[model samples]
Target: MKAIKVAILDLYDGHPNQGMRGFKEILDRYKAKHNLNLVYQVFDVRGKAEVPDLNFDAYISSGGPGSPVDSEGSVWEQRYWELIDKITACNQQADSVKKHVFFVCHSFQLMCRRLQLGEISLRHSPSFGVLPVHQTALGRQEVIFEGLHDPFYAVDSRSWQVTHPDEDNLKKYGAVLLAIEKERPYVDYPRAMMAIRFNDYFFGTQFHPEANPVGMKAHLINEEKKQQVISEHGERKYDEMIERLEDPGMIRLTQSTMIPNFLDQAILSMQEA
Candidate 1:
């Protein structure tokens, strides 16, 4: 049996987080269910400047805590970019089995900046809740988002957003803006890009697709986090999010779909090749 190698780039920078736990749960489930020879290794990209070599079938870069804008020219950022460059080069080859990548949250923000796909800037206020993201036309046809509701809910906690996409670069890279935050009819503000297909082998989401409702609810119920949500997003919003956590049609549906679907597609393609 051929081994399926996966590289997990940890960008959390030592902050305690549920994202890494979420990733582990999903990956473990998939590996067992498929009964495949799949192995994954973690590289602490931000904390230790550690990066994986171009010897893996797929890579998943995790979300982190910091400004994606301020990390430019840093050692870790440079090394990360170098890995991406190598992946891009390898994928461009006709004979090579292409490498797959999925960027989440903060990593998604950095990808937007790196690809010059959008303006990465601070939000008017922090967005911290399980919110609906409406899919674009291309997103509807996207394999990873297949069978997902047009307006699916996912956990979105970020101090920054990607807005005002550059049309030329998007076309140049053959990248499709997959999804966006729910439109505010009353506000004259640009909707943040919630997802983007960077290329055939590369995809990303601004929300945490690995965030299962049970885990999300657990995090929310933490006293400090509970107060933070109530203070920033409002008490009613916090209560509403709590209520929605158990809804089968909300974040649960999203968590079960996106990341798992991406893995299915990648694994199948690589195995077939």
Candidate 2:
């Protein structure tokens, strides 16, 4: 069998954080566990002028720190747009082989903007910690959600989200909303789109399904981050988050499945092609 060529586009300009490192480690484990030849490479897409050729079987984009629309006109954003365009073109040109794309957080926002499938804007209150999200009707039938819970927990820490998604646009582009935020008690938050699928070969999650829960626990409790959370959301909210993160079942169930499922689907697609 040919080795699955996977390209991980690291949008972070500097050193990858523990969460990013954890994601890579999980991918490596998946490669070994599935007994598959997986060749993984990372590219820094911060200031590049050209999009590298879309020759990989699967492409994954990492989350960054801000709104994708706000980063418009910057070199990094331009390159990202170019990369997506190339991927779309490649899929269009290919008859039997379709390159797969998996976007996380910021990249998901960027994809939504580039595709014009929704509006992206700052959230009134940032979502942080393991959020409970429920799959839509289409999501339940999607391959990625197979063997996963109906309502699953996923790590989230973002100030921007897809709001008022254009359903018509999504369908026109062969995209579908897979999951959305479950309402929280007493919290009148806007309904945020949690996952999206563009055709059979492209998918994205607004939450960090790639995030390692144990690593995320440590990340949240870091002195600097903890202090920031307390200052921003109040001590009570910070305490609540800390308590929620301690649930071993939620953490384990949330972190264990997403990447593996994505890899399984991508590998099957390659083999069938």
Candidate 3:
């Protein structure tokens, strides 16, 4: 077996987060369980402006706190965009072994903007919960979502969203909008894009599929986070989210399905190449 190299881009800076833990746990578990010949490393993108070279076969960019838009033109953003561009160009070569990328929330927002996939903007209200996500025609056919139901649930905690699909741009790049946020009958706004296949080698979700609900619930139940959620989303929502976090049918299903499936496919593609 050829050794497979994976680079994890940490966007959380220095702030405390469950996302980093979630990624490492999933990777560690997958590696041990499969006994695959793989090695992974992490680079602090925002705090240190550190980005990986093109040596890795795959990359997973984690979600971070704050607006993806406001950070435009920052030093870190420039370096990050260069990495995206390089990998994109690398995949364009017919004979080169492909490089796969999976973008989480904050990184997904930036990817949408960079690719002109949609309108990147703030939501009327921040979305934070174990929310249901609906699939598109394309999404239903995606291998990454296999074994997952149409209206699956995942952790969505963000103020910015990728909304209003730009059909022409998507067509121009051969990208397909995959999944979207569950409709809000009373909101009178287009559903935000929850997932997209940016290309054959690139995939992303506007929610955190790698979130460990157990860890997340522990974070939320803290006195400060509990009150904060209640203040922002209401007591009822807070309680519902807390309950759903521990449910096997909700985030646990998603947690076990999505990212693991993505890595499975990515590793297979690497070996075949």
Candidate 4:
């Protein structure tokens, strides 16, 4: 079989702690574990005038720091929106290869906003750290969450979230809400949407399933970031995050299955095709 080509839409431009690296590492592991042929390419979409025209079996959108709404009028944002439009258009064609898209964090918010399936709002306080998320009734039936436990812990860092998801709109689009926040720990905001499925081939997650626990520990331990977290969420929360990072089980519980499951599904699809 030919190698499965995958595209990673990297939103962060040369950040030292880029999440795409973790994603690539996870996918590479998956390929080796399954003995499947898979290839991936990264496209940095920041300040770009045009999106790349390349054919791929799957696309993964990486998370970035910043509010997606704040970037609405920017050149990079507009270009990305156009790119997503093109992807959506292609998916609508009968002859086109079914394109799979996995959106994370900022990209997840962007997709929800563009589809008009949810409301994105700024939170009174930023959410940063591992959070407990519960699978919805529909989520339990989804293949992506297979073998994963309920009330799993996943890394979360966002200033905004999908506040009031339009369930009617989601159903109209043939989408399902996969997961939701178990509790509103910060800002007393209502429970936030954790995951959603727009279709069989498109999904989004509000948390960083690609983030490695070791990498997260390194990122969180940076002196500047530690102080920043302390400033934003106080010293106690920061300390808790440090403590949580030490437990490998806690880090591996929820996030380890995400990319692997997505890739396994893609492989199965290709084999069937």
Candidate 4 least-lDDT 10 residues: 46-55
**Residue pairs in collision within model 2:** none
Off by over 4 Å in 3: none
In candidate 3, residue 66 scores what lDDT?
Answer: 89
What TM-score does model 2 achieve against the real structure?
Answer: 0.90
- What tens-digit string does per-residue lDDT give for candidate 3 at 1-273? 778889999999888989999998888888888998878999999999999999998999999988888899999999999999999899999888889999999999998998888999888889989999999998999999998988999999898989999999999989998999998898798899999998898999999999898899899999998998899999999999989998998898898888889898888777787
Report clash pairs, candidate 4: none
**Against the unseen true structure, what C-alpha lDDT does each candidate score?**
0.91, 0.79, 0.92, 0.81
lDDT of 1 by residue, 190-237 (tens): 999999999989999999998978988988999999998888889999
Per-residue error (Å), model 4, residue 164: 1.0
lDDT of 4: 0.81
Candidate 1: pairs in clash:
none
Clashes of each: 0, 0, 0, 0
Model 4, 1-273: lDDT tens per residue? 687888888887556554887898888887888787788888888635435564778888888877778777788888888777777887787776667788998889988988888888997678888777899998999888887778777888888889788978898899899999877466566888999998878899998888788778888788998898899889999888888777765656555688788877766665666
Q: Cα deviation in Å at residue 222, candidate 2?
A: 2.7
How many backbone clashes are present in model 4?
A: 0
lDDT of 3: 0.92
Global fold similarity of model 4 (TM-score)? 0.91
Once model 3 is optimally superposed onto the true structure by TM-score, how far is the C-alpha of residue 118 displaced, in angstroms?
1.2
